[model samples]
Target: MIETPGILLTILSFMLVIGPLVFVHEMGHYLAGRIFGIKADAFAIGFGREIAGFTDRRGTRWKFGWLPLGGYVKFAGDMTPASEPSAEWLALPAEERQRTFQSKPVWQRAIVVAAGPVVNFVVAIVILAGFALAYGDVRMPPVIGATVPGSAAALAGLQQGDRVTALGGRSVETFDDMARYARIRAGERTRIDVLRDGRLVSRDVVIGTELQRDRFGNEYRIGRLGIAGGKPIVVRVGLLEAPAVAVKRTGEIVSMMVETLGQVISGRRSVKELGGPLSIAKVSGEQMSLGLDAYVFLIALVSINLGFINLLPVPMLDGGHLLFYAIEAVRRKPVGPDVQEWAYRGGLAAILALMLLVTFNDLGNFGLWKNLAGLIG
Candidate 1:
């Protein structure tokens, strides 16, 4: 079992990870709604009971909620208590429905709904770029630092100080390239070109797999070449390069997100890999233990995940609303309320089921169930 400090660290990690991400996501909605001339009823950080609040001149109630899980922005005429109508609202007496959301154009509405995810993506990009610029990208160069004795590299006559020049005839520029090539060829012998003692040499090296574990007891299989590499060399960049770096980082993260989703859908990744609040809390705690930089990185990563997940065309999510907008745009009418309600219910059910499943996985992974079984035994 993890010690008390470890457990506490995990909890703090989740809060740090989820709080800022959720805040930024909700802020996107609030800001977009405001910009599009849609009156916001409330701009909230967190949910449930209001802990702190103040009404703006525009009549938008900005507040912090008691529960810190997530947040929402209530717009005027949103069909629910969450929004007020902009048209009918304005048609009313001067004092009556002054700032309703329904008065906004469809384009405005779409932008308001889309803003939440957009903001999250923007936050992710900024975080990634800022981190990259501040720290300089530390990547493993193709140079080998150490070779494991009696391992595949040793058996293949690969030695320390050898630089990986190419893999499978493809030139390797960085450690990431070499690692990716090796991972794809896991359990298979592959041709590797190395610069050894200033001479280019080719060798057939078989990648071996080993079981790796996290401090939290999570285990996974990783391909190993029994060679260690150096840390990333940080390079400072000017303002001009920052934006490009940010875009590239965002693209890389998006690619990773898509690939991970594909793996999960294809059953190459376990559904047990899905994490819920508990898992997030555990991670948050761990990140807190590692200090601020790691915690910030985790927050950025989770922000990206939240943005990506919400953009999925699943009902009851921001993406689901956007899907409805797309349909409405095509049909020149809004989706019927009955259909929307039913779809929302279905989405809710699916989300709840997923939550339960992920929570169960978290418990099992945390050894809570095992401990319970031991107690009974």
Candidate 2:
């Protein structure tokens, strides 16, 4: 079990990571509204009771809330932070209604809602690009520098300076290709073909195992080939190209998330694999212990995940609002107020259920259930 201080570290790390991201997300919405001349009523970080805050000259209440889980922006015509239309605000005079959010065109309203997630994505892309430009990336040829003594590669007669051509029947063109192929088959038997003295040689061996878990649910077998990689060439990404590289990397992460979700839906993966804030807190602590770089990367990753989740067309989320806007655009009228009310209610129930399930899974991961059982007995 983690000690009390370690637990405190985790809580602090979670706040450090989450607080700024939430601010950026809400700021995105607030700024977008400003761009279209809509006035905001409040700009909040977190939820629930007020912590420390002040009202801005624009009549916007800027405050931090006790609960620090998420945040929102209340626009002029909103009934609540959820952006529900206000009956009283709707009854205001024509001049007073001019700057309200609901008075904006459907397209403008959609942009305001989407700005939150878009800002999250932009933050990730900028951070990743900065890293690539500053630290460079691994892009080298596939050559073995040395094999670990008494290990699988050595036992299989592999030698230093050997160029790997293929692993497990897959072609290996770069060092990254070899690493990617081998990292998934730990402890499994595999064939490796190498180029030595301009001749081809093949060997069969069991890929060594090292279990790696980045988060609560994301695990990798991380096959250890027992051979050191050749000297990695430093490929300093140019400023002009860094953004493209960042975009590609971001796309890959999104693809992985999509694939994982598909697997869960298809029953190839369990619903328990889904994690929540508790799991995030735990992993945030772990990454902080590694180094600032690792923790910063985690922040970027979580930002992207936040963007993707908000883009999902589930009711009560930003995407759900976008979905309603899309329908309004097509039909040339807003969704009926009663229908929206019922839909939001259903959405709230669904979100609550998901949160409960994920929290239960997180507690199980922490062995809380086992601890409770022990005490009960």
Candidate 3:
């Protein structure tokens, strides 16, 4: 049976988690544009027909849309959601044009476009840093307590009490570090370095893969070295050091994301494993039920994902705008409107197709497809 959080709670949690992130993302663009004296026409929390709004003293209309999917900041002289320039607005008098986004220099335009995703990363770092400040760090040594029989480690001749020093040419300091390294190297031949009885030993092994199910019955395929940690150690973090720790944690998470994408592209993983807004809602509800701490951690994770996705070089995304800016910087002029319009259309179609695919995956995960098939039969 498919178990899920109550529908009411799911909707509430989805809004609670997504709304602020969207606001923060758009706010990044707004602030960056303001810095360059670019006037915003509107700052909206969502798309489509506005539900409620007010014009700020600066003449920027602040509005909330009925749909809670995503948001945008409409700057003066922007003709499309992609933030393409409008020729009519660009043709305004010098005094009037000075306050429009198209009037800004290319460098300023790049920063304004990049600020949205960059702010998402900054927000993620802040949330993660808060956790580090509160919980401290685990200082587990990379000592192998035992190896599973017939598993990759044992098959490679790994033994108990071996102090793991490195994996795949990278230094591994602690058990957690080794686990992290192993998690990404599944099914790959790797060189593992260890100190065996005070002597250096190296083993070449093909890391094993495992399909594991969580309490929620969610299946995940992960890498495994089949070796357990020796013991536990924990250390408190200083106030000055927590941010640095969080930064490192953020970098690791980004690395994992990049690796996962590479795995998917290389056909080592399936695209069906990808999640969408529906998945976000389900996970949000589940995490919220776990507790506030769990929910907050989810927020940080989703923040990083949002930042990373926006940085992709797909049209209609922040990175696409930056790509255009880079081209303009090189060509000494902006791309033609006809070319930009076609690119935006392609981007929108790609985004929609992806949404449909992930939504299909979500339904499969919820067993909805099976249920419908049973009914039809």
Candidate 4:
């Protein structure tokens, strides 16, 4: 039912964006398993029927599946793609048992499970650094170039030449830092510290709210500081410095994600913001249209999200495996298979419900139901 001429572009963009990321994630687990001397039964990209495949010398089946959403590395003792242990795993010969994943030490298993997310974070940081090196960094100082006549900045006695030093106790190193802090607290009162004409002055300002709309017909209430920038000074850093800057940027992003999640959980943010694969496809297509740089940045952002989401303490995920390992380490024995099975079932149900909700949100985002209703009317 996708009638847009750009549908093909969307599909291609989705594949390009997700394919490498999923491959990287699974490869992390594959490499770690090999390093720990655990035997892998299969190293597969995607799920369902295999389109093409080959058996490696080590007896592992490496293949590409028909579906292209996600991938997995199935270790020898894994009963399913979720990496649960099977009866067959326990029934293996004593010699063969040594090579199975479950036969490995708990620490080894934890490392293998944790590697996927760790690699994802590393890859994102590297890619971001590369981009920073290529594009150069924006060196805009946090000085006020101008202020709206009737806006918050003017009300707060912020002059055009005043240099913003800090906001709400956080130091501002760049215009980005000021903008980031300002955008989240519409109509909230905060203290701004500035250097004006060789003197330091502190002023109280109430963040102003403005309604903004996107091309997709979505409207957002965003905080407006009413301060404008003149020109940004661009400086390209050495390769060594790029990685450090990239690490800082990545950490900032992760921090923001954690804060947003906490806000959502505590009822300060709306659940409607959660997205699924459909939303990703839409964004991927949008980024593709914006050119290669945007698309690459999008990939980096999604990669970070993937890595962080996998680390959440939910069963059937990498973090779930680590959680179980933690309990085993504490109690000196693994939880009963029945308990693990029930927990996995509950996790699967929660995941499915969340997927459905996000898919519904995607439909709403696309205006599918709204358009359909309009047509019917």
Candidate 5:
């Protein structure tokens, strides 16, 4: 069983990782609202009972809530759960409703809604750049450091110290590139070009396959090349190049997220592979055990995930709100409140169901459920 200290550490780690990400996301909305002359009634850091709060000079109540799950920005004249204003708001005196979100121009409203997710992306980019600049980028070159005995690479006469110059005629610059190529070509015959002992060599390699588990406890066959690469070597970059590195890193993260999501949706990956807060806590705790760099990298990766997920066009998410704004922009009118209300209700249900599913997977992955089942058995 995980100890008390371990559980507490996991909880604290979850808060640390999630709190700032949530804050940055909400701040994007708050700042954009203010910029568009919309009055924000409250800017909260969490949900549920307010633990502490103070009203700013601008009349925005800044508060820290007891529940650390999520937060929101309550706009002026928002009558229905602090989202876009309702028709009742429009019926109010012109001056009184002026600051209402729905009263703003469509473009401004879109900006305000889109800002939240955009801020998440921005935060991810900044964090990536900062880490890259401070620690220098460390990555493995496309060189084979080791090969498992009897593995495909070994069987194909591939040996340690062989640099993979190309795979299937595609130039491989990094180990990751080679891995991706191998994964995509799994179970297929492929030609490889290697530099061995300063001599160019060619070989036919068949990618191996193995079962992999996702965070959701779902398993799938993933292509594997039975070769390991050396540890990443730090590559320093100039100040001017830091931002470029950050952008590149962010793009790579986004691409990975897209691929993962596509695989999940296509049933190539299991739904059990999804993770929730529990899984994140576990990962954070594990990273804490590794050291400061590992912890920071984990946090950055989570931040990127948070940002990318919010950008997904699902109801009750930031991206969903942005989608509504897009429709409003094109139609020159807001979506009907009834339509929005129904959509929100459905979205909330779907999100809650997903949360429960992911939570179940997390418990199973952590052996909590299995232990309980064992006791029953």
Candidate 6:
């Protein structure tokens, strides 16, 4: 059970982590629109009823909303928060049309829509690079430091000081490579190549499976090798190489998320693994407790997730706008308004359903429902 003080810390930490990232995301859209001479009606930090606001000299209403979950920028002539064009947009006079989003060229519109995600990616890269320079890179190699007595490695005749060179005939670059393959291929006999005492040795080992609980209390069945890894080496990154390393790390994260989503879709992974806002809060709290470096890393990781999710080709998302622009470019015209409206409605519903599912999972992870029942008793 968490103390009251701990709960407060979690909420405060969540706000500090999420607020800046979200503001940065919206700032991208605002800056892009302003650059292209488009007028913004409002720049909001959250949805729902406005708590406090003021009109800028340029006539944009800057406000903070009560709900504090997500935010949007209302472009001039937008019908809704989704940026769908309304009768207000179409009814604009020739002179006023110059300041509206719809009046911009298709390429310019695409840039404005894509800017939010792009900014998120940029923020993530910058944070990661800065952290790498500050802390250096501590990475573990594929060397086996010790084996569990009478466990898989012991039964397979694997010894300490052995370096894993390949697994199941596939070249292993790091310990993570071997572990990733082992986790998915559990309960199967696998072939491994090890370099020991300047000699290459081949061995067959049965991957062991175990149930593990994450910090959020979510259970996962992961394959274990019955061997512990050696100490990680700290490699300092130069300023010139930091950005490239950051980019590579971002790409790796994207690839992992894509593969995990693919696995979930293909029934190889569970859907409950998807987290929601509550999970974010829990993780933010945990990372904050760990240290500044850990917290900053979480921010970067979440930023990448935010950017990647927005780039998915789904309606009511930035990627959806890009998709429409692509189609318009190909056909030399915009899609029908009725079709776009319906697509947006459907997309909104889909997003809401996904949110509900992940929130339910989060509740279960925290044992909220179970605790409530106990309290009732």
Best by lDDT: 3
Instruction: Name the candidate, 3 or 4, with the larger lDDT value.
Output: 3
Candidate 4 lDDT, 117-163, residue by residue in tens = 99889989998999889988887899999999889999988998899
State the lDDT of candidate 1 residue by residue for 1-377, as single tens digits: 64334665565567667877888788888888767666777888888889899998988888888877667777766765223234555567654343455655567777887888898888877887888778766566899887888766787888778999997788888877777655534466778899988899998888887776766556766667777777667668766787787777677677667866776788766787777888778777776676788878877788888888898888888888888878878988878777877888898899999889999998987799999999999
Write model 3 residue lDDT over 1-377, tens digit each, in one string: 54667989999999888888988998999999999999999998887799999999989999888987668888988867555656687678998788988788999999998999899889998988899889987778999999999889999898888999999888998888888877866688999999998999999999999988766668777789999886687678888998898899899899889988887889877888888988999899988987999999999999999999999888989988889889999999989888988998999999999999999999998899999999999
Q: What is the C-alpha lDDT of each candidate?
A: 0.76, 0.86, 0.88, 0.87, 0.81, 0.85
**Cα deviation of 363 in candidate 6 (Å)?**
1.4
User: lDDT for model 5, on a 0 to 1 scale?
Assistant: 0.81
Model 6 ranges with Cα > 4 A deviation: 1-5, 67-70, 80-86, 139-171, 180-207, 213-220, 227-231, 371-377
Model 3, global lDDT: 0.88
Alpha-carbon shift of residue 5 in model 4 (angstroms): 6.4
* Per-residue error (Å), model 5, residue 366: 1.9
lDDT of 2 at 351: 94
Error of 2 at 256 (Å): 0.8
TM-scores of all models? Answer: 0.78, 0.78, 0.93, 0.89, 0.82, 0.84
Q: lDDT, candidate 3, residue 363?
A: 93
**Residue ranges of candidate 2 with Cα displaced over 4 Å:** 1-5, 67-70, 80-86, 140-210, 213-232
Q: Please identify model 5 stretches exceeding 4 Å from their true place.
A: 1-5, 68-70, 81-87, 139-149, 154-173, 180-223, 228-233
